[model samples]
Target: MTPPVPAADAPADRRRELRADCSACAGLCCVLPAFAASADFAIDKPAGRACVHLTPDAHCGIHADLRQRGFPGCTVFDCFGAGQRLVQVAAVERPVADPGVAAAFPVLRQLHELLWYLTEAAGLPLPAPLRAEVADLTGRTEALAAGGPAALAAVDAAAVRAGAGELLGRVSAAARPGGRDRRDADLVGAVLRGADLRRHGLRGAYLIGADLRGADLRGADLLGADLRGADLRGADLTGALFLTRPQVAAARGDGATRLPAALERPAHWGAAAPVRTRRPRRPGGRGGAAGR
Candidate 1:
């Protein structure tokens, strides 16, 4: 039988519970993924080695100045609370965490990501059956995350993700009637300024460097959509679905960009895009007194 996921045993904020608490983590991310030197990362680091900037106590040496120190890539990385969960649940003690943790972190991260999505989906006005499905899947996913490292290592994470994706697709369809579907489209650097893209399905779309200034993106489904350097000045994203912090932080959005209440305006973005308003012309014609 699957074990119940560990919780705080009292009323708590699920959103906060699902977020990264690096203080509680063992710095799993610093040692897990290989880093390629690029615009995002300053150095190429091999996997399974602690980052050069990682402190003895599992803290980042350049936490406040990561971007300035050439590690902007680390700024947007979130494990959705996986690292800490492993530290707490597995009782990992480290100068080096157990090899099992290295093996299990990726699997646990994926499960935790699914949990984040399911939690958001539950809040949407899904139908009764869909709501129940979300609840069931959420429970199952929690059970998967609750397991020991052995069980986590044995899980077919991709298969579980595929199942969850299918369910999310159905949920998206129900929630977005007659929305345009653009799943997995390579729309890199496309100019879509001032477009009406409400309720559009853009799952897994490559929107890299796209110009999206002043676009209306209300209720758009942006699951796994890459928004790296995408311009979102004055774009309205109210009610957009499945839009995560990393995605928002990667994109360029000014204060005028209307984000969903759940997300914060990225600090890097400019204060506000210039607002344009048309001046009313006098009925007389062009260059009339009012127009002047």
Candidate 2:
């Protein structure tokens, strides 16, 4: 039997930085963003309007059955804990119907996404010099996030993203030396099942709807890779660098898929069998007859 590989564990601060805390949030994602009728959404909603599925208590009415209710897009969308922070910044206790708050959502979302990447970069095993640089970047971004709505809205988001992207690019290069430079490659609908992509640099690659089943992706850098609708069933992503929860959520996978430790298996991935232990089974055991 293969030894169980430990899932990637993020530092607590970084984990909190990346994961959504909906209870503390004001249902900003449901109210602030617009949606159009598509495969991902069942109806069209204008910005500043609460989603039809949003309940009175700021919970998703179909939270447990989002995918079954034609809202897989909601399942895949993550604000990296930005929604709550935006609510706090705006001083609102619950979902606000104000247009200004709605307008600031996109900007704050981008800033928080930057914070997510920078926070992740800080936790990487980079050289001391690079680590210090990452820390500085993270601090600057956090300061910007702490600024209220007006300051956040005033930010040049595009310029900030570009600057942070450069630093993250260096971090990716240092982490995965000699990896393939496949950034922004258009591989949509490409059939790459069972390909050996170990240690490849796939940053910003457009892999929409790509068939990656059973592929070997060990140690590959997947930063900013567009994995939406990509088939990752049974793919070995052990040691994959820069793979985020949002990226994994956007892709389709199965129980056999191997993922890094930091990400949870998407619920859409069918139920996985419980891991077996080394203990021998007792006589007439529920699992088997005396370890047959």
Candidate 3:
């Protein structure tokens, strides 16, 4: 089974569990997961097989050019620090090409993701009762994660996620007072630029390809929201609830975009086109003095 959450003063490393540390990882993601030749991948590859783009040093050979080389999906994927943690827990001394590590990576990943969500939930400001429940659940989940590989393999991650979802729902409801319930709304390719979505309940909403430029998303609950291809230029997502790093990484944003405290601006965001402003015309006709 998975481990319980550590103490309140748990080691700093445990508290910052979701931050990806690729340098410390054994490239489990490049070798363990199966990929089909869809819009996401350039070719089909079986599970436990390393990608052709992976280098001898367990790094992606095309890391800097993934999107240009037909692997845009790779750019959005994140293991949430699970790859490195799994390597340590599984005692993986060999390269990621080892079938044993590949086979166990998926299970460990699921457990780690649960830890990530639970850790986030625990930090939310909820009612005393709800906060206590979240603490309890987080502890239990952390305990499961601390278990050995055999225990992790036997964990029911879906069930844990379901339970955590209930707690998170309550947390969302409490955080976003008077928010609209737009759960699972089909907003694909929407033209909602500059819209006021502050404090809205957008859990699991399909916002893919939506025009959200300059939108106000403060305090909005975005758990599980599909933000792929959404334009977030000049948008303010400050204090937005449950906005995962992967969701932000999948969307498009410019330098003017504001994010929640827990998240970081994705590196790809630096490539976004800069926002332009029109210069004001002179008070008088072109080449004429004002008030002439």
Candidate 4:
């Protein structure tokens, strides 16, 4: 047996940052994945079926030792704000266990993830032309986040994408000096640590070779954005609207990568880091068995 990797303790400040309103949820995240008996997972679970490792109270069995026990994937998965966006904001009153709720879960989950990116994007600098819209956009994002999952499921996705795209265009403009007409600007090879590109449009922009450590890409629209060779260490891509699957699939990352809601790290990235042991598993939660 692989010697158990001791869990790392989370820094107090960081723990406060990752804290979320999980109480408003019905534990949707733990049960929705397409699980199979693979190196990363010890069980085979179907879509819509709860994972065997999930306790009756809807918590992970292996809340600790995630990497050592072969469920490291859970540790790196960030719902960004998808869980709260759906369960608390959008689906406020409806219990996820309700008889009529099953059919929309998949779509709702994806939509909530998109919302997370957009909300994050809204914080970026806006062009003079779009600055006026940022306040309204921010308010709207907050409202949507507070809407329950059921409310989110009922939204028109196309409209949401369009709004996010508009915001991205504004961010792209602000990135340029003197507001140069850089609608097609190239940011490849730029060192952009902690740069705020929230809600900015970078559609079809070139971002290869950018060192985006701690960059805020929340709610920034990235449709057709070229991200080849971009370094996203510690970058928060949460709630970036219009970020397509292919764009994310094409981007590269390592252990330091942090994605927005509902997205998992690439299998090639290896297992998620072990949870810190300082934070003991919440009382009454169970740890996963070696195999299911």
Q: For this target, which candidate reaches the highest lDDT against the unseen true structure?
A: 1
- The TM-score obtained by model 3 is 0.85
TM-score of each: 0.87, 0.87, 0.85, 0.49
RMSD of each: 6.5, 6.7, 7.0, 15.9
Number of colliding residue pairs in each model: 0, 3, 15, 38
Candidate 3, 87-189: lDDT as tens digits: 7887765356565566456666666676766666666656677768877987887787777666776777788888888888987887678988899999999
Q: What is the model-wide C-alpha lDDT for candidate 2? A: 0.82
Worst 10 residues of 3 by lDDT: 1-10
Error of 3 at 267 (Å): 1.6
Instruction: Compute the lDDT for candidate 3.
Output: 0.79
Give the true-structure RMSD of model 4.
15.9
Q: Write the per-residue lDDT of candidate 1 for residues 1-292, one digit (tens) a residue.
A: 3332322222237778778899998788998788999989999988888889899898989988887888878888888888898888788655354678877889998998888788778777666777789889999999999998888989999999999999999878877889999999998999999999999999999999999999999999999999988999889999898888889988888879988766667677756556456678757768645456
Better structure of 1 and 4 per TM-score: 1
**lDDT agreement with native, every candidate:** 0.84, 0.82, 0.79, 0.56
Q: By summed lDDT, which 10 consecutive residues of candidate 4 come out lowest?
A: 1-10
The window of 10 residues in a row where model 2 has the poorest summed lDDT is 1-10
